[model samples]
Target: MTVYDFAKSVVYGVFKPLYRVEATGRENIPAEGGVLLCSNHIDNFDPILVGMMAPRPVYFMAKEELFKVPVLGKLVPHLNAFPVKRGMSDREALRKGLAILKEGKVLGLFPEGTRSKTGELGKGLAGAGFFALRTDAQIVPCAVIGPYKPFRKVRVVYGKPIDFTGLRQGKGSAEQATELIMSEIRKLMESSK
Candidate 1:
């Protein structure tokens, strides 16, 4: 098995029971072709939890510093993670993201750019919208509900693929696209209430 598959199995094995995690609407994930999996970030394990429940392998763009840590740095790469310089227009990171989508892979992104301390949905950065506008990849909104406290049930809900047909043309800006993405995510979060 690939490292991603093995790691996913291991993570699912450990986190599912511990957190009593349940995933819904997994069928929303397109079985093939590139996919942009956008979600709101909560805890540090948000990425792990999302990846664990994803129907397909997901490649994430993590912060550049994460690749500098001891063992995690070396391991994250194998887990299909690459580093991106936050708080600026990191062209290299943007290029890498586009390439992943062009290759028909799932590029997971936390559109808020960082985890929310208040556990509330935050504004989405234009980066995700840029990718969406640039590629034909399916945009799938995901929401992770509940606290990370052990024994608490956490629900990871994947919403239906977004229809960006109108936004694809030269008429829509990336900021507009991002707002739409965030609205869909907000809807998902509200539905879980």
Candidate 2:
């Protein structure tokens, strides 16, 4: 089995029962083609939780520092993660994200660009919208709910793909697309509550 498959299997084996994690609407994610997964970030486990529940493997753009850590540096790459410099525009990161989508892989992104301190949804960065606008990838909005306290239930709700067909032709389409993406995530959050 691939490293990602083995790692995911191990993570699922551990976290699924430990955290009592549950997922819904996973089928909403397309099985093939490029996909942009936009979700609200809340905890350090958010990426792992979301990735584990996805129907397909997910590739994430993690902060550059994570890759500098000795163990995580070597491990994350095997798990389909790459580094992205936070703050300011990181063209190399953008290019990498675009390339992943072009290859028909699932690229995971946190719309807020960082975890929320209040556990509430925050304004989305334009990066997600930029990727959506630049590629024909399916933009799927997801909500990761509940606390990560041990033995606590954590719910992952994946919403339907956000339709950006006409929005792509408009001015500032990326921002508009990000808004819609966040809106759908908000709806999923409310539904879970």
Candidate 3:
């Protein structure tokens, strides 16, 4: 088995019993194509949670700092995670994300840019929109509800894909796209209630 598949198996073994994750709307994910999974960040485990639930192997744009850790730095890349410098435009990271999508892989993204300390959805960054617009990849709005607490049920909902077929790539278009993506996530969160 591949390292990613093995790692996911191990994580799902523990996650299913501990958190009891429930996922819905898996049908919304495209079977094969470049697609972006835009999710709201709630905890450090959010990426793993989403990846475990997704129908396809999901790659992520993690913060650069996480890659500096001796073990995680070496391991995350094998799991399809690349590092991005937080709070600034990391062109190289963006390029990598685009390349992943262009190659028809699933790319995971937390548009909020960071985990919300209070477990509330935060404003989304334009990076997700930027990639969608640039690559013409569909964006799947995902909402992960509930805190990362043991023995509690956490819900993950994937909404319909947002298409930016003809949208221009710029500050204004990116911001608008980000807002639309966040709005879809908000709807998914409400529906999960």
Candidate 4:
């Protein structure tokens, strides 16, 4: 097996039992091709939830500052976590993200841009929508509920895939379209919870 596959397997085997990871909607994930897995951010373990549940390796965008950590910087990319500046638009990150999709891999985006302390879902960035529009990638809305605590059941739910292309067809900027996309993400999340 590839190192990435082996690492993901080892991590999932260890934590899956420890955290009692219980996820449904695995069937909802597309069996082939590239797609965006948009989710609500709660705990630091959010990406782990995706990694364990998704059948394939999921690439996530972290902040640029994370890659600056001494040894950690060297490790994050190997783990399929790349950097993005939290507040501003980083064209390079977008380019990387697009390239990942173009290469036919799954990309993960936390619509909130950061962890949600309230445990309630937050508004998502337009980037989620824009990505779907730009790549014509199917958007999969995911909801992770409860258990920032230990030994508790962590429920990860996947909602239906959304095609936002028609919603923005020639009417607005990528920014405007993204806001609308995030709104749809919010709606999907709300319905699942």
Q: Judged by lDDT, which candidate is best? A: 1
- List RMSD in Å for every model shown: 0.8, 0.9, 1.8, 2.1
Candidate 2 Cα lDDT to native: 0.93
Per candidate, the number of residue pairs that clash is 0, 0, 0, 1
Local distance difference test scores for all models: 0.94, 0.93, 0.88, 0.78
Model 2 residue runs over 4 Å out of place are none
TM-score (all chains, Cα) for each model: 0.98, 0.97, 0.95, 0.88
Off by over 4 Å in 1: none
**Candidate 2, residue 172: how far the Cα is off, in Å:** 4.2
Cα shift from native, residue 4, model 1 (Å): 1.5
TM-score (C-alpha) between model 1 and the true structure = 0.98
Model with the higher lDDT, candidate 1 or 2: 1
TM-score of 2: 0.97
lDDT of 2 by residue, 1-193 (tens): 9999998999999999999999999999999999999999999999999999999999999999999999879988989999999998999999999999999999999989988999999999999999999999999999999789889999999999988887876755778889989999999999899
- Ranking of candidates on TM-score, top first: 1, 2, 3, 4
- Per-residue CA lDDT of candidate 1, range 1-193, in tens? 9888999999899899999999999999999999999999998898998888998989999999999999989998999999999889999999999999999999999999999999999989999899999999999999999799899999999999999999997568999999999999999999898
Write candidate 3's Cα lDDT for 65-152 as tens digits: 9899999899989998999999899999999999999999999999999889887789989887788777767789999998778999
lDDT of 4 by residue, 14-113 (tens): 7778888888787877877788888888888889787778877889998888899998898788888888987888898899999888788899988778
